[model samples]
Target: MRTLIIIPAYNEEGSIAQVIGDIREHAPEVDIVVVNDGSKDRTEAIARDAGAEVITMPFNVGIGGGMQTGYLYAYQNGYDAAVQMDADGQHRAADLPKLLAAIPYSDLVIGSRYVEQTAYRSSATRRVGILFFSKLVSFVTRQRFTDTTSGFRAANRKVIALYANYYPSDYPEVESIVYLKRRGCRLAEVPVEMRSREAGRSSITPLKSVYYMLKVTLSVLMSASRVRVRGVKTSG
Candidate 1:
């Protein structure tokens, strides 16, 4: 199957090269597409040097916008599957096969921290918010989710088309899960270990984290009321 590993980068020069190189080594055949989202640094150059087919947006469009571009590219190129991976070093390339294996049977496969066992460590406050989001997903989708904030995920053509057509503009990680589920898209998770960022401070500072959680929760809760999920299946 044609697979695209879409890396959304924003001022991620420090870790972009490493992330791309690791993916190339582990999944050499998988097409790497780096969406350089208005980075002020050399993120695009580094990604290019690492052999990723780069897409440079004129300005920083944030995570959701960058990801949508990837989806659009996948749809246009006729790719069968696409993986959303963060440019930060937190996500591992080694766990890609499990995600790929599940994508054929499931519309979406999330690289989860608590699927089979908990192997992730983060701040306590962050954990609380994540747990809350997990419960919220379960409530909305009628399926228990282990990780709602994970960016490491793989989606088949159907899910890719959905995102390309209509994607949440801001804070999409949790909202997209609800959107996919409403469409009757099957979802699964694989246990994957996450690492600390190799560089850069997170957008979610302690003070900002509180506000982000509140804002995201309300937005998702409101959007869920209007979402419509289509049952996507392969034509035989």
Candidate 2:
């Protein structure tokens, strides 16, 4: 498949190069593009130097906007598949092939760490959030999801076009799945190991954790109430 890896970064200069290098080393055949979300650091230059296409936003548009930009690029440039990964080195490039390989069978493939449990550990608070969102989405969509908050995912042209037009603006990972499911998209998850960030810090702090859960919960509920698209053929 002709795949484009989209890495949305915000002030991730500390680990951008290493992330790019890991992709090149593991998934050498696919192309990569880094969406610099108005980063104040050298993320753009370092990503360019590391040999990946860089799309710099005028200002901080957050992860949703940055990802929409990358999906727009992939849709316009005619990429068969697009993969979203983090620039903080938490997502593994070695799992790229597994994601892309599942593209033929599903409209969207998520790289999940909890599908089978492979040495991936998180804080108690984060785990609770993940579990809560997972159960919520599964109940809403009537489909099982082990990791609803995972950013690592691969999308076929159908999903690329959908995401290009509309994506959740904040904390998109959990809500986006419900959006696609309502539109009759096939979604699957594959087990993958994730690493702790080697640089930079998480945007969600202890204080923000409560807000994140509340906001995402509302978003998922709202997304679930939207009318389902009729006769949407997502199968390849």
Candidate 3:
């Protein structure tokens, strides 16, 4: 199947080239697209020079908007599947094949850091939030998810079309799991190891993480409460 690797970058000039290079070295067959989310740095130029198609947004629209743009591109261009990855070097390129391999049996496949009990450790505060959301999502979806906030994910054509039309604009990864569960989309997880960021600081501070937890929890609850209507159509 034709797959597009969507790398959403925001001021990732320090790491974009290396990330793109890794993807090329590891998953050379899959097409790559870097959605530059209004970065103030030279991220776009670096990605373009590295031979990945670059899509620049007018302003910083967050990860959700950047990913939606990629889904739309994939949908329109007839890609059978698309993978959402980070340009910060946290997500390993070697795991792309595992994600793609799982796509045949599931509508969505997530690269989970905690699935096999790896050495990947987060801050205490972040781990608490991850555990909370993992339980909450498991309860709501009736399926256990070890990593609810993992951005390393792959989606098939149906999901790509669905997300292109109606993706959450903020804190989307967690909320998106609930959304897909509501629609009866099959989900799967694979064990993958992630590295610490090679460059650039995370946007989520300690205080912001608290607010993120509260807001995303509320969003997931609201999403779960909605009734699933049948016959929803999406452009292929």
Candidate 4:
């Protein structure tokens, strides 16, 4: 299948090259699309130099918008599947094939941190927060989501159409799980080892994390209650 690895980059200059090169090394035939989300740094140029097809947004559109643009490009370009990965070095490229292999059986394939180990070495509060989000998403979608915030996922044609059509304005990882569930999309997970960022600080501050959870909760509720009007115009 023709797969496109869509990396949404925003001020990720330090890791973009390594990320792209790693993907090329493991999956050289897989196409890459670097959505340079208005990086104030040299992320776009570095990604381009790394041999990825770059799409520069005039401004930072956030991860949701950037990923939707990837879906648009993938659909228009006739890609069979698409994987959404982070520009940060946290996600490993080696685990990409595991997700790809499972995409055939499901519309979405998630990289779960809680699939086997629960006590991951991170901030105590952060782990609790992740578990909270996980339960909330599971309750909403009737599907267990161990890692609701993992961006390392693979999507098929159905999911591409779904996202290209009702993605959220802000954080989309959890909301997307609900979105796909509403559309009868199958979801699966595989263990993908992740690492701590070696470069810039994380954007998930305590306040931001709280705000993100609330926003996602609201989005999930809104998604669950909304009537799926057939053939209605949607922008995800």
Please report the candidate that would top TM-score against the real structure. Answer: 2
Sequence-dependent TM-score of model 4: 0.93
The lDDT of model 4 is 0.85
Sliding window of 10 residues with minimal summed lDDT for model 2: 227-236
Query: For residues 109-200, could you state the per-residue lDDT of candidate 3 as single tens digits?
Result: 99999999897877787788889999999998899999999999999998998899889998899999999888878899999999965333
Better of 2 and 3 by TM-score: 2
Per-prediction RMSD in angstroms? 2.2, 1.5, 2.3, 3.0
Model 4 residue runs over 4 Å out of place are 118-120, 228-236
Residue 192 alpha-carbon offset, candidate 1, angstroms: 0.9
Better of 3 and 4 by lDDT: 3
Instruction: List TM-score per model, in order.
Output: 0.93, 0.96, 0.96, 0.93
Q: Write the per-residue lDDT of candidate 1 for residues 58-164, one digit (tens) a residue.
A: 98898889999999999999999999998887888998998999987899999998876656677788789999999988887789998999999999998899889
Ten contiguous residues with the weakest lDDT in model 1? 227-236
Top lDDT: which candidate number?
A: 2
Q: Summarize candidate 4's per-residue lDDT along 92-185 as a digit string, tens digits.
A: 8898889999988998999987797633457788778788888988998788788988889999988888788868768888888987877667
User: Which model is ahead, 2 or 3, in terms of lDDT?
Assistant: 2
**Residue-by-residue lDDT tens digits, candidate 2, 101-177:** 89999999999999995888777887888999999999999999999999999999999999999998888999999
Give per-residue lDDT, candidate 1, residue 210. Answer: 75
> How does model 2 fare in lDDT?
0.92
RMSD of 4: 3.0
Please give the lDDT score at residue 122 for candidate 4. Answer: 72
Ordered list by lDDT, greatest first? 2, 3, 1, 4
